[model samples]
Target: MTRPQHFGWFLARGFGPQGWGYPSLDWDYDWTRPEVYQEAARTLEQAGFDLVIIEDSPSLGSPETIDLRVRHAFGGPKHDPLLLAPYLFQATRHLGVVPTVNPAASLPYTSARQFATLHHLSGHRLGLNVVTDTGSARHFSDAPQLGHDEAYDRAEEWLDGIRSLWHSWDDGALVADRATDVYADGSRLRPVAHRGRHYAFDGPLNALPFTDGEPAIVSPGGSGRGLGFAGANSDVQLALAPLHEKSVRDYRARVHEAAVAKGRRPEDITILFAIQPVITSSSEEADRIVAASARPDDAALQQIARKQSSDLETDLTALDLDRPLDLSIFGAHVSRGSIQRLIGDRGEDAPLRAHLTALARAGRLSDRTGFVGTADEFADLVEELGDWGNDGVLLWGDFHPVTLHRTLDELVPILRRRGLLRREYADGGLQANLRSF
Candidate 1:
């Protein structure tokens, strides 16, 4: 029998325009309103998902690239996901809502208080998807931008400071003695005075102690320092890698090694790989979709260019497709990983058209853990991951009802029948739900 695995939904587009550039936009639900997302949150909880992780980029890129970021509604004009978490909590009973938060954007004290209040309000189902994107430093009062490793170093300090505040209220701090009308014991509160390299704060956090646990910590970093940060601090590691068994096992092993180095057990962190699978009705239909993608026409290639341009924060559509891309066109702030993903197996010398075409190509479900498949075929991959000692998977897409149903309607029952997806949530909050498996 296969052990059950956890499941989550990733709001890949963040709190930006939903259903944009898709046929579903015709559904006529206002993206700015709370009702659409609330309905989707309810649907996810009913589907037995453990959490929903929201992705955010606090800045619209530097002044030079703002147009590329939002022209196609790919990157910016995002309302804070942190602000949307409450509405999601109001709509669902058990689903955890994790919003992306950058350490540089807000003060540690402010983040701690706000997150603590939400964690308590949501019955401990809140999570913080901590990110270390230095690109948004300019928006935060000209915060000092650090190098890659140094950013992680600062994040470590930032997280430590937050945790210090969370623990400032001791276990017995809340006495709640009705007989004497004493709500809390002041003596039990510890005065936290932290002076770190990255941040300094004094706190006996005004928020009360968490009865269940502090808000869950989620991290998405794949670098060596990134993995180390996840191992030392994260409760859930938002992972990205190939879905093949060996690759999955290797990635898990690296996280485990890092955890052991930090004197933590491997099981302390749940590693959830991000996947965007194309679910089809039949194998033949899946085959047809894959075949059509092998040679994308001009229109399809241009569509791909728009997305790539948004992600790279550089315009690819304006470039001559026949000529090789000049690496110098990308600004210093562009993510190296985003650039590498755009230029996959092909070298930098390859023409821009070749690179885009490679990205446009699609693979079959039977092709080495490929994603294009029927529901049963997709279940096979999920079961295989469970057998490989995998923790879980996060399905990536928009946070709209249409998008959720399109993916989960056919896939959920198949997974549950195979004992791969959870059928019910446990009593504790999100952390409890993750650990219940």
Candidate 2:
């Protein structure tokens, strides 16, 4: 029998936003309405996806150059992903809703209360994708920017404080006694006090107890400190390594080892490799599609430039694209991984203009890394990744509406027949469903 695997959609684009600076496709999606996201959630639920993560970055790039940011809408106008939770929860029964929350910016007490409240309201089907606010230093005016290691240090303490606040009220603390007029047992509640290196919180949370223990914690980071934070606290970790089998296996081993060292079982943590599948009727058609995506127009190049500038934390508009890449221009705050993934072995010595030209023409840096084939062939790829010990895959495709619809309607059936995907949800909430595997 084939082993079943978990599935999730990386809703980074807020459930298919229209005119979002991508090459022209077959469909136009209006993402401003919540119904679009609701429909997507329902479709995923029907397809037996494990969860849908809502990514949010509140601040646009540097104020000095906000025009490109607004024009591209990459970091500009973003609806708070948390606002869509209730809509999704009301629309679907089994699909888990995960909204990214930053620990460094938001207070631990507020996060603890909000997430716990969401857990109760959503019938114990909530997940928290925790993030450390390290980039965009201008956004956090109150505090100085922190190094990667220090950011994780603060996040560790922040998570601990949040957990303490969650436990302030015991499970059986609520007692609505009409005859005695006692709403809650006072003995079961206590204030949480923590004075850590980075955070200080003292509180018995002003909310009732959570229905399902606590929301499942999700983390996304590939750095050593990032893996450490995830291994210690996260129930699910997004593995964004190159989609090579050896690379994924090596990363999984590191995560498992870290969890084991922390006195936690390796199997208890789920690692989902992020992938974008280019599905078509045949291998030749898929190749044609991939080839087309590589030839982006002038408008497309501008969008890529804007997005790259944000990722590297430097304006690329000023760079002479035709000249050799000036490594000094990036300063000390550039995203090393982003640049490495782009140019590969060419490194910083490659021509700057050639890189942008290639990016605009190719559309994405990882065009070759993603699986490209028919639905059945793509299923084979998913199973192969499972063999490398991945819990499942986080789908991040730039799929057209028709393509996305077919993925749910056609591709999922293939996986179901192969016994690699679930036909129905297990009898429990998000945490139980996630840990079932």
lDDT of 1 by residue, 22-59 (tens): 99999998888889999999999999999999999998
TM-score, prediction 2: 0.89
lDDT of predicted model 2 = 0.75
Which one is best on lDDT?
1
Clashing residue pairs, candidate 1?
A: none
Which clashing pairs does model 2 show? Answer: 294-361, 294-362, 321-353
- The digit string of per-residue lDDT tens for model 2 on 279-366 reads 6777677767667767666566656677777666577777766667777765443455566655665667677656776654422222
Candidate 1 CA-lDDT value: 0.89
Give the candidate number with the greatest TM-score: 1
TM-score of each: 0.97, 0.89
